[model samples]
Target: MVPSDFKALIQRFYQLQSERIETYRLFEEGHEAYLRTGPHYDFEHYKQLVHEITQAFSGISKEVLEIKGRLRELDQADLCEHIEKLQSKEKQKLELTAKLQLAKQQAQDHPEDEGCLEGIQEIKHEIIKNKEALSEIMQDFKYDSEECD
Candidate 1:
């Protein structure tokens, strides 16, 4: 049987993931507008949106890391190993998120620069790749959870 605390963590993780996805969608919409219209894009609003989503991502990542640490303390070797792998992926996700934020800031600061626009596009691609990797990691975690049962 799965521990109640573990179940709770999973639920919270899902909730955070849902919020992150929605925030990402909004950011994508804003980014697409900026890409199409260039100077007409609302830089301040775009920055604010990215900043908000980044903050949310930071909070959720921190909490999930804490939960993973707790899971590691449970003394179940296989489960602990699985959590470690998940944590590693989470770290990569956080790094990608930071890169994405930096790219957005650069694009905002240098709206007229082609290099800045290209950097944003490249970083967006990296973020999407990282998200796919994260999805696979989550799937692994689910499989691990069932095996633990």
Candidate 2:
């Protein structure tokens, strides 16, 4: 029989993914406001949002990854591996997002600061490199979960 804790852990993982989708909506809203803001975009706000949620998600993912051994013991190795891959990719995207926000803040805070715009350009390139990774993973999880679908 599956342990109650395992079920709970899985539930937490899906719950986090749902929250991530809502988070994406917030990002999209901010993105669409580009060129419309009066003084500046709210990079500071998003920076804090990214930092806090990333920390929280990292903690949850750590717990989930630790439980994977038990998942394998219970013959759920495939699911365990999938989570491992998705988590790594998601981490990369989150890191770049944090960097992008910082660059935006730097540019906004000091328009005269050298390289701030270039730095954001570099981060955007990295984001474009694997932009589809998150969407692909989301689609895969969506098929299996009712959380973010």
Candidate 3:
């Protein structure tokens, strides 16, 4: 039989996964609505939906960090280290994403500016690099988790 604390941890993990899925679904719906409505779409509402998705992911990420701390406390050092690495990669990805967004906005606001265009391109490359790094981290975590099972 599984220990109660481990079971509870698993349950919480599943719950966070479910919430992330639901949040992604809502964000997709809002995106589709915006695309369909085109120029007439309410940008604020779509932005709010995007914000909700970000908040949902942020909440899950925080929980995972806490879980990693718990695992460390329980002497599951390998798993905790994997989680820590994943979290670090995730943070880098988030930072790159924010930079990309800012660069895109600058490009949009100054379409004729060569510097702005160059900045956007550079930021896009950085974002792609960070995404690839994050993907590798995720794969490593998956392999580690599977080995544990």
**Best prediction by TM-score:** 3
Model 1 scores worst on lDDT over the 10 consecutive residues at 74-83
lDDT of 2 by residue, 1-149 (tens): 55666566567767766766566566646644542452666657656655666576667667667666666666665556767777787788777876786677678767897799999899999888756776676566545433312
Ranking by lDDT: 1, 3, 2
Question: Which prediction has more favorable lDDT, 1 or 2?
Answer: 1
lDDT of 3 by residue, 67-96 (tens): 877766666677677677766776775566
Q: lDDT: which is higher, 1 or 3?
A: 1
lDDT-better candidate, 2 vs 3: 3
lDDT of 2 at 122: 93
Q: Per-residue CA lDDT of candidate 1, range 11-90, in tens?
A: 77667667767766776676666555554656777677768867876887687667667777664555556556655766
Instruction: lDDT for model 2, please.
Output: 0.66
TM-score, structure 2 vs. true:
0.57
Which of 1 and 2 is the better model by TM-score?
A: 1
- Rank candidates, TM-score, best first: 3, 1, 2
Over 4 Å off, model 1: 76-128
* Native RMSD of candidate 1 (Å): 4.3
